[model samples]
Target: MLTVRFARLLLLAALAVLPTLSHALACKEGGRNGNVLITEDIGTTVAVPVTENTGVPIWHSSQRTVNVHCYKDNNVREAEEVYFYPNPRPKQGQPQGVQFGVVYKGQAYYQTERIPTGFSIPQCPSNVSLDKCPAVSFTLSFQVEIATKKPYPGNGQVGINQFEVLQFDGKYGINNAPNSNLVYKVTGLDKIRFIQCAVKVWLNPPNNTLD
Candidate 1:
């Protein structure tokens, strides 16, 4: 009977201490297990201008997208270059310049496609009605897979398991003003499964210009 009671006390002590140790392990800066989730911009859209002074041509003044690509093998790299080429067409009314060549760079596995969402209106004079001449907007959706590998005890080796973002817009901004980075977390495992990522990008037009 005395042994039984002693064993029960020891078990309780272990349970209490185990949690404390686990908490400490969880607090470590870089543990074996990590997280996997794609980050998206918080804002809805960023406005870009389609002007001559601008470095390149773009589809719309503001645009956003989520892209993805499926690979047959895992030997691919995370920083692989993905290009998005817009459909070609002559500039409306102006029969002068070429109208295409807006490529967005992203991971190699992701495909090239713009997933448009909506439009925006630049600040114009009060006398000007924005309904007819409102600035255009495009939106895209991003998707990333969740990590499947259990957190090991060191820097985890994670791949772009599966990811994509929808792209919106055709024209590029001057100096590439409207741009941001994708947010990601190494929260857990190396292999990830169905995770969702959403972000929006837009541009601010040139100080005084239009397309």
Candidate 2:
């Protein structure tokens, strides 16, 4: 039997601590640079028991898709990069539980560095509204590889259950271009890097552990 683990502390912290933006602006058509609205939608993790249905030991690959939309408001200043700093440090010099990364336009981004959006919303036409102009529309997919049939070499466990589904990818911090006077916030947590469209996270158990 393979023990499935999912980390949700970050998710809970994110939702529980979502704060109100004093400088928040409405985001919609004609709305410009109000604020960078982000959404963290949760995804489901399905685990199959070690039975005939899953002949060989099962390997699950979890993923999270973050769709970032930069809406324009009155006080908008164009900038680049959405920063995310992992709260707790990652496990090093030990077995890692999971491995995850971000993908943008066929490019893979690790949590260790600044996350690139590769998108810039052009200034809205003077005569038109923000929506009337092109949007900073793009998707960054988080890829997670949980376990393998073969246990880790030294530590013989289904796999080194060392990695945690990122509340933040790592101790690393991700943010928009430095000194743009602009920043990205995780709804309330504002310090988190995850959310929106299929979280690919765990449910129930503390570590989101599934049997």
Candidate 3:
């Protein structure tokens, strides 16, 4: 009886550890042997006020360049070009929202197919009444590109991305005293990053104002 119980416990322990081992192996299989070489910012920002009478959405855009370098052990190795768009444009049958893309060698490679898993908009101030306060919202558009081409002897590649604005600011009222010169500002982060890629770039403001 003692021998059987010991054997059963051993079996249960092995079963528990098996899943962890398998998961580690799976992560290794998907791991890349490449590192980011550099990232360049090349996108322009624009801010436009939304017409108070015509509540239209504004789209903000930006772009960047990323370089990837692959290596085997301590030495450089050749690897296939992998493309990614952190934010992508909407697809057919999808709602009209901002999307991002990745360009490779002057061509489109990857674009975001869905909305961002993490997104939020600020609520109107409590002091402002709903009737007097106009509703406000904005969208962010981005593009990333690969600057290097394939079949090259070098272990690195390069691409360029672009971001542009459809709109960034909105004017609620005509600078009237009752409205308190209400304006909506859509400001972007100074820097943005993508997973597994080492590229840092600056985002310029669209600087659109209405008084």
Candidate 4:
């Protein structure tokens, strides 16, 4: 009986010292407009301006930044490139020469046919934060140009909306080659799955514009 009581006390003491790790950035899926299911893993929507010229092709210009944090895991990396699921499809107008670019060297923008995410830790006004940046974050610039000279009918969200944000290998963000050294699995959420990755949105003008 003494051995049994002593063992129980030891187990209780060990349990008392166990660390309670909170899921820092694992948010529940199905985030509605302006609503974040979880607080830490806040989702966001980036707005782009599609200006229609009187004679020339419609011009779309936008630059913004995203913020991210990792409290429970370590060695997260920003992906070299992340692809958009369901492929970005324009609903209203046909966007010609539509391309997504990532700003590199703070001088030239690297264009990509796929989508990319940049985290700033706190929302920054510009694609590349002019102010101080967090330890693990960067900016982004997405530009769409050369569309038919037709102004959007009115104004509505016309960009990649509510797509699953996937993570690839890196020391800044999420990774797909889910290895152990730098892998970060969520507490109760799947980072790449639809359950925890509803982290992107692009709104369009109510006009006949393409995202």
Candidate 5:
């Protein structure tokens, strides 16, 4: 009984300390600002944008995009590249340009062929309707990639083991943006049968200045 109690106490202590340690690590990984971690699990079909506390422009003014790659237990299997065009040509279609699909176990289970447009208005004039003044937005999608050879019974859901986010510099031309890439390594994927996923990214201020 004493040994069991001691183990229980240790477990409680570790659980209590884990959150603090995680926060510290996040800050450290992010440097002075710390890293912004986002996770999407089953049933979550929306992308949540990540905002900075320092109040600096994190995204390029004209070209804003996020590249997401899904991994199966650490190996990348599918990818999606979404582009947000603030002022896309009329009649061209939605401002969100998407290129990619969600694949699992070497088979594509979902694709973003007709996803809806995601947009938001930061500020609206007194007379202008908030919906009319669009400022920024993005879309999110999710799916389970199960092994095709031997499918599991029931939901057959295979949670996303890991994923990666590649935030490109919108200010610089696409050709040069690769040189200034900001990659966020995300882990601890949800274990639910189905996964909810959302992704939001912004460009960090250059030199921490408003330039």
Candidate 6:
């Protein structure tokens, strides 16, 4: 009876150790679930104001992209392209001109010199009143490709020139535009050409306390 009990105890211990051994072996063979290698090329951050408010300043509507070059172990994927659509023209004004270039309010603007292919938004927050808080929103429109662009290389040129302002209630900053906030129109998207790239972006309202 003593020998049998000892044997049973040893068997239970072995069973417990087996799972740990199996997990250790699996981890050793698989590595750390791999790593998500992120190579980001963020273009200059231009402070485009929310024309609707005078004192309450909003920022970060400028086009940006992050080129996810690989997954783990530097594995390459096919090239992809994304073409984002700008906001439509507001009710008033001549609807700005893309031919002469982008113009936010009365200021002239230019597209980012370089934009990456794949990117994502980590978080977003919102509010009903600008005085109490501000909300952030992100919208991206573009195309992707299955074939990689490399070696000989291909061009991934995407034009990002357009404006879209959120309408703020009177409770926010000094509401300027008719809708209480600012409004923008995307005049051109059909006129540009890009090879293999995906466009990703966000429209976020800054916290009112900042201003």
lDDT of 1 by residue, 26-50 (tens): 1011211221124333222212222
Output the worst ten-in-a-row residue range by lDDT, candidate 2. 186-195
The candidate that wins on TM-score is: 2
Per-candidate Cα RMSD to the true structure, in Å, reads 25.6, 19.1, 25.1, 17.6, 25.0, 24.7
Which digits, one per residue and each the tens of the lDDT, describe model 4 over residues 1-211? 9999999999998776442211122211221111121112212322223443323322323442233221112212222222221112233233222222233225323232333333322332335443232233222333222222234323332322222222212223222221211111111111211111234445565455554
Ranking by TM-score: 2, 3, 4, 5, 1, 6
Every model's TM-score: 0.19, 0.30, 0.23, 0.22, 0.19, 0.16
**Candidate 5: lDDT of 118?**
30
lDDT of 2 by residue, 135-155 (tens): 455455544332222222333
Write candidate 3's Cα lDDT for 1-211 as tens digits: 9999999999999988654332210000112322212223433332222111222223322343222211111111212111122321122122111223333334443332321212222333457553333232222223442222122212121121233211111111011112111111122312222223344355455465433
Task: Please list the residue runs of candidate 5 whose C-alpha ends up more than 4 Å from where it truly belongs after superposition.
Answer: 1-160, 170-179, 194-211
Candidate 5 structure, TM-score to reference = 0.19
Candidate 2: RMSD over Cα atoms?
19.1
Candidate 6 lDDT tens digits, 110-175: 332213212321211242222222222223322211111112112322234333322111111122
Task: Give me the displacement of residue 63 in model 1, in angstroms.
Answer: 20
Deviation of model 5 at 198, angstroms: 23
Candidate 6 global CA lDDT score = 0.26
Model 1 poorest 10 in a row by lDDT: 23-32
Error of 5 at 208 (Å): 53
lDDT of each: 0.26, 0.33, 0.26, 0.28, 0.28, 0.26
- Tell me the deviation in Å of residue 156 in model 3: 41
User: What's the count of clashing pairs in each model shown?
Assistant: 46, 30, 22, 31, 13, 23
Q: For model 5, how does the per-residue alpha-carbon lDDT over 1-211 read when each residue is reduced to its tens digit? A: 9999999999999988654332210011122232323333323332222221222221111122232221111111122222221211123222111112332223342232322223221333456542343222322333322112222223423344344422211211121112222233223333323213445455575346443
